[model samples]
Target: MHADQRKKLINELTALIKGGNAHVTLSEALSGIPADMRTTIPDNLPYSIWQLLEHIRIAQKDIVDFSISKDYKTLVWPDDYWPQPTDSVTDEQWADSIEEIERDQQRFFALLSDEGKDLFSPLAWGTGQNIVREAMLIADHNSYHIAEIIVARRLLGIWK
Candidate 1:
């Protein structure tokens, strides 16, 4: 791709990863939620805000690790990706989870910005998965779950 095109791609990907261009950011969505509200699963919802938060963090970390780690080990499906609804977190743990999500996003953004790495080329360790595909996956996956978090908050009467 041309230099301008490459820069634009990276810029768009960064925005997608950071969110708020077309939807609420993770930070904005989670902000002001009372500590007690974090674990309150609404009547019909499958997970609490805490579960969604940890799930997003875990899944994003897995994607980032798989993208760049040479020694990536597979995490179990559903079980590893989604936290137990009964699992509660300390205030510190909640903050750490959000921090880790943002930090991993920046790490993935760095990978996207590295022109030296071909985004279209599948990593030798991955089966036909490339950085471009992984970028799209993370953007789609995060936005989907983040919206769920927003919906969960609305259901819990915590969001405006």
Candidate 2:
């Protein structure tokens, strides 16, 4: 693709990944959640706010690592992606999760911003996977969970 087209594509992908265009941003959705409520699992929901936050951070980190690492190893489903309900997070840990999520997103953004990288070209190490597909996956996955976090907060009567 031409430079103009590539730059536009990068901009759009960055917006999508940064979120808040169509739905609440992950950070916004996560903000102002009561500290005590982070561990509370609303009725019928399988995860707490803390679990959702950690899960998003972990998955994003994995995707970013996979995108950049030639030796990326596949993560175990449900196991590697989701945090255990039994697990508890401290206030510091919660903040750390959010920080890592943001860091990982910036990492992916840098990759997308790199003109040397071929957005459409499949990685030689993977089976027909390209940056565009991975980027969409990141945005799509994060948005879905962000919505889930909002729903959890709403269900808990914590959303304002």
Candidate 3:
């Protein structure tokens, strides 16, 4: 791709992954959720808002770490990717989780913004996976969970 085209692609991906798109961004979805509702498990739902938030944070961290790490090992699915669901999550824990998510997201954005990097080139340490693929994965995964949080909020009557 041309240099200008590459730059446009990066900008678009950044917006979609972070915020300012049609889908609800993580920041928007998490906004105004009361502390009590974070751990409240609505009927028929397998996970609470807190669990979902922590899971997203954990998965995003793993993906970003895998992209940059020279020696990356796949995490054990389901168990490793999700936090233990409980009603004991405190406000501090929620804040910490959000901070972790934002920090890793910034790191991922830096990776996307680096002009020296090739989005299409496969990581030498990994099997055929490229930065672009990982970015899309992060965006898709985050969007899905953010929507889940929104749904949970709506069901709980916390979101208007």
Separately for all candidates shown, the number of backbone clashes (residues 3 or more apart, or on different chains) is: 0, 0, 0
Cα lDDT tens digits for candidate 2, 22-64: 9999889988988888999999999998888888898888889
Q: What's the lDDT for all of these models? A: 0.90, 0.90, 0.88
Give me candidate 3's TM-score against the actual structure: 0.94
Per residue, candidate 1 scores C-alpha lDDT tens digits across 1-160 of 8889889988888887788989999999889999988888988889999999999999999999999977999999989999887745789999999999989998999999888988888999999999988998998999999999999988878889
lDDT of 2: 0.90
Higher-lDDT candidate of 1 and 3: 1
By lDDT, the candidates rank as 2, 1, 3
The candidate 3 region of ten consecutive residues with least summed lDDT is 19-28
Model 1 C-alpha lDDT versus the unseen true structure: 0.90
Q: Which whole-number lDDT from 0 to 100 does residue 137 have in model 1?
A: 91
Runs off by more than 4 Å, candidate 3: none
Worst ten in a row by lDDT for model 2: 82-91
